[model samples]
Target: MTTDAQAGPITLADVRAALADTDPSRTNAGALRKVLGRGSYATIQKHLDAIRAERAPAPPEAPGAVPAPPAEALHAIWGAAWAQAQVMTLARMERLSAERDTALALAAAQAQDVAGLAAEIDAQAAAAQDLADSQAQALAAAQGVALEATARADRQAQELAAARAEIERITAAAAQAAALAEREATIERQTLQAALERQIDKYTDLKAVVDHLKPMAG
Candidate 1:
């Protein structure tokens, strides 16, 4: 927990402690900011977002569920409309051919009018084709956005996983180091005890020899 005059770097441990008593569903930016002092809403939000992102696993693909069209319902509606237009265009051509035949029996002026109507139909078809092309372009753009979102999610998952693995490795290494230190301390204690015991034995032997020599000298 490090802070400056106003705000500071919010650690993962600090965030966890702040939310320890709070309900998971109620843990929002405001709630976190209340417990974790000195950070702005954005700072709290950034830490909270990272916590959630790290905790969340990547969503699994639904089995047997078809991937949705890029444009979703809009694409389907437009596709159906385009298909209907093709059918109507064919029917309109048939009607125009019958009308042209009728005009041929009537006059040159009516035949000219039928030619105009055919031109209008061709223009409408071109407009419909243009609309379809625009929709296709829009769908492609949507697909690109979806792909980018997916890639971002995958990257986050991988980074979180790596972080967890590194933490575990550090923890295991610390435990091993601590155990080694305790063993070394125990060995040093035993060595000191053995040295002290040897000194005591030598002192006892010298005392006995000194006592025996004093009686002889006497």
Candidate 2:
């Protein structure tokens, strides 16, 4: 016959006992407080909150839907995406290099043609000085075109490298977010399970008390 006031702390058992002694017509916080003796309103509210959380229904899953993927599944998805991106990047680099090599080969061929024109100019300088001057202008233009092509190839390579770095940064951020979400879900599930267990124990103790009193009443 320990009173709630003398007890170390208010427990689910104390709350159940107070509810049992309260008048059915006056089943309210005030009535329960009277039965609980020195237990404060806050103590009664804490147990009530626990009961509500325990009895709360679980959220229903979508029909035909699978449960959320685990952390490893998320990691695998990220890895697959990363691998695919790398493949595409490598292919792009290869194509760019091929185009650069083709441009360099074309430039080399044009320079060989210019060298043949120069030899002809030297052989017929007095008779075709004007023609040799025109060929000189053509050679300069070809050289300019070749330099421009080389610059373009360099720019493309730089751009490709920047794009790859951006993709890697985004992938890492996504993986980190997924890991954090999984951890939070795990913590929430554990907390809910613990609350449910406490609720079950409270009800079991209340039922035992009712059974013990039944024999005496009979």
In model 1, residue pairs whose N, Cα or C atoms come closer than 3 Å (at least 3 residues apart or on different chains), thus clashing, are none
Candidate 1 C-alpha lDDT tens digits along 38-149: 5678867777777787677799977896776677787889999999999999999999999988877788777788999999999999999999999999999999999999
Taking all chains together, each candidate's TM-score versus the true structure is: 0.35, 0.38
Please provide, for model 2 over 1-218, each residue's C-alpha lDDT reduced to its tens digit, 9 standing for 90 to 100: 87546676778777766666433334555666777676678877777566556556899977996788999989999999999999999999999999999999999999999999998888788668778788999999999999999999999999999999999998999999999999999999999999999999999999999999999999
* Candidate 2 ranges beyond 4 A from true positions: 1-131
Alpha-carbon RMSD of each model: 52.0, 70.5
Instruction: Please list the residue runs of candidate 1 whose C-alpha ends up more than 4 Å from where it truly belongs after superposition.
Output: 1-128, 201-218
Ten contiguous residues with the weakest lDDT in model 2 = 21-30
Candidate 2, residue 21: CA error in Å?
99
lDDT of 1: 0.85
